[model samples]
Target: MRKLLLLLVCPLLLSAQTPADQILAKAKAYHDPQDIWPTLETTFTFKETRPDGPDRSTIIILDNGISYMKINRNDEEVYEVNGEVAEVLKGDKDKARALVLRNYYLYLWGLPMKLYDKSTPEISLAEDEKVGDKLCKVLRVVYEEDTWYFYIDDFSGRMLQYKFYKDEATGKGELITLEDEIMVDGIKIPQERSWYTLPEMKYLGTDILEEVD
Candidate 1:
């Protein structure tokens, strides 16, 4: 009886791990069809829509870790950064804004693909969830700084939306919807992201990928 119970429990434990692995594999394939994160070279235009003000646009060129970003709001030529060295080619630039812009672009552009990186958070399967009317497979990612929940489409395996908590214990978080998709170098990327405060569902701004190369 003891041996039989052990045998039964082993398969159950193994089967439990299978779903998360399968979900991750499908998501990776959908986002990075060619597996081109390491050598990804592309240029795209990012536009931010504000609730109280006019829209802002920036042209961003990313070649792996090196990037060149140009903002239309200012006369500051082009801000270029290669590894640790950063500089402006034409006019006065705000270093603080440049840093934030660099992280903002890189993080958004490298989605489900970047989640697979070793330095990123550890990903595990969470209870199944629903985003609006769509049923999704929930993925719980625990990073060093915060916890994030990702909702992947049940049928398509594409990432539909994600949420991050400001205070995990209190369940205070924000949800971001990934809407629209475009292909860049065979990889499918979310073209627009709309953010909202969780629970209350207050509307934030949207980031639009206007152009891509």
Candidate 2:
């Protein structure tokens, strides 16, 4: 009798979650099946290519459990942040940019999982969007001043692209298309990200993940 009651309540519990919750769960399962991101400690080595500049190489070390991060560009120190304080070791000494990059790296690398962060105010199911030839389920996340849309493959639950708008009404923002994946520490992370202007689709650049440690 107890086993029958448990089986009956399981489906009901799952169905009670909103569409946004379900989609996020699927996406998270694909990206971080082991659920190890909260205490994740890893190093990322990547190359950045842009039409306007020469290719650049960057290395980033992150330990999410302690909120610690360090970034290096071309073998030179860019910045390091531990907890709330950030320091720029060389170059311009821009603490502001360092802090921003801290958030930027963590958020981008942490993907659908980061969407569940407490700092994230809202996530909702949005109309489906086509990424290239494949149709994807869309998730809209609202921030204080910006709105972001993430396109996830319906069947595989992998993130295909994401766009953020400063002006939601005018759709003035950038679109980032994800390609390929790198498996590191049991996590599937997008290998390449191509950036373009929203409506114009002006080509910007691509960030390619080369290796991880």
Candidate 3:
């Protein structure tokens, strides 16, 4: 009788740690050094050399928790992706621009500043250590039925990488990985990035940033 009682109480004695709390703690510990991220917003330039391509021009802009974005590419048309087709542009940089913007927004906007809210579900630590040099805390977020995974830097509170996945009958889920970092003006930046549609084939992309502050 005592053994049964103890066994049931063991779980209750264990601290209730949710995924969101785990991620928040990890990020806070990692980024205890910088306040720069709180003001992150600017245009990012992409020097694209993908799966098998030479190079191209691309630019992305993000402002105010990233409610808006604009893209311009050398050989592509400008099309926006914001839970829907946001807009279109007719210019030489439209295609490449839109591609970069879509990918960038997909990669960035899916994160959390205050995750205790109900919008993010499955808030706990996941066994996802393949995204970066340090261990990553995966936070499963859901807003209005749409969900995503945010990979945070364990040693630095900054969000160094993010991924979006969806299961479909015809097409498989895709994976995007961020890596090859360099510090520019005290801010860590991604020097090289790769995207895998089937977790096999990867498209290499570059980020060239210029400070405007």
Candidate 4:
């Protein structure tokens, strides 16, 4: 009778302690407790440094899904897109560059918090792993086009690093270390990100969030 009782209780406890549920709860609380994105209205500056090229700076403003991006490489205002309308403000902006910048800023600045988005991809818990010196709880997210691995700090429940695969089968990808943070309007945003090539760990450019509001 005692063994049967223990078995029943054990199953209940396991169901109550799913890894995805626990990790997501902590992640959401740490990153965006107030759900700022729906009414998010803010501006920030991104300074990018690359080993192969001159530094580039951009000022980005996102007001409720409408976006304006200014590319400072040549002191040019390159793109502006709002709802159904899109424009190339100046300097012969191409659609490819515009799209890259759009996704780049949106993805990096809105991380961990963005994991909770309504359109968020399918997410599941993976085995725990160490990122740099910190042990992390791994969350694997699969989008339509790519798969991403987010490493949440085991102790603080904060996202410390992430990896993305260009080809999931080959596992060739990049890893980014998220460092420094600033709280803006109840959102914890990473202020700097350094990227490195996977396996080889080649140094890539760093994107620094210089200013925010």
Clash totals, every prediction: 0, 0, 17, 0
TM-score winner:
2
Any runs in candidate 1 off by more than 4 Å, and if so which?
Answer: 1-19, 65-78, 88-97
Q: TM-score for every candidate vs. truth?
A: 0.81, 0.93, 0.54, 0.82
lDDT of 1 by residue, 3-119 (tens): 999999998877876676678778888888788866788888878797977787777777873444443333345677665466656566656656666766777678887777777
141 Cα displacement, candidate 4 (Å): 1.2
Ranked candidates (TM-score, high to low): 2, 4, 1, 3
- Estimate candidate 4's alpha-carbon lDDT, on a 0 to 1 scale: 0.78
lDDT, model 3: 0.54
Q: In model 4, which regions exceed 4 Å deviation?
A: 1-18, 65-74
Which is the leading candidate under lDDT?
Answer: 2
- Candidate 1 similarity to native, TM-score: 0.81
Worst 10 residues of 2 by lDDT: 71-80
What is model 3's C-alpha RMSD?
A: 8.7
TM-score preference between candidates 1 and 2, better one: 2
Reference-based lDDT, residue 171, model 3: 39
Position 10, candidate 2: lDDT = 97
Q: Scored by CA lDDT, what does every candidate get?
A: 0.78, 0.89, 0.54, 0.78
What is candidate 4's TM-score against the reference?
A: 0.82
